[model samples]
Target: MNSLQDALYNWLTIKVVIDERPDDTAAVETEKTFYDMLKDDHSLTNIEVTKDDEMYYVHFDHEGERKKQRFPRELIEVMLNQINQQPERYRNYPI
Candidate 1:
């Protein structure tokens, strides 16, 4: 498959939120882990994560435009774990 096909077939859906308040130690750590996974995963592109006032913002580019989504702090860890723990059968296949 080529880039177009890869982009067309590849999809990533996540729940995230935005808050202005500073995050606690645990939340901060989860954020770090989330970012670490993003960095380690080369298949991800045009992704952004930010937090303020307890709200977390997650965004990534799809097709030609950027898309955004929100998720609560409590659920970020869960989402992170889900992404990190994707089963071998669900992982992207090399073209």
Candidate 2:
């Protein structure tokens, strides 16, 4: 997967773990994994993820310019659906 898709897959995986085990400290590590994956992209810096009532916002610097991308809930769901079709691509178990 490309960097963005990899980051989102990690985000979704950790989110499921967080929801299942809210008190698990290891979830923090999984969250960091998402950021670290994004940071590995040479073109991106200062990456951040935020959410409001309806959308997720990804902010970063690309090639020294600031940029942001918004992903609607439906878009995320669509990605999740696609991911579900090939669980082994992102995770060892079903998300």
Instruction: State the lDDT at 77 in candidate 2.
Output: 55
Candidate 2 per-residue lDDT, tens place, 1-95, comes to: 46675565556556545554455456656766666666765456876767787887778887779888776755555544554576566453333
TM-score between candidate 1 and the true structure: 0.35
Which residues of candidate 2, in runs, are more than 4 Å off? 12-23, 74-95
Q: Write the per-residue lDDT of candidate 1 for residues 1-95, one digit (tens) a residue.
A: 23432222122222231122123344344445554454354244577667566555667665567776665555444544653576352343333
Alpha-carbon TM-score of each model against the true structure: 0.35, 0.52
Q: How many clashes does the backbone of model 2 have?
A: 0
Model 1 misplacement above 4 A: 1-44, 77-95
Q: Give the TM-score of candidate 2.
A: 0.52
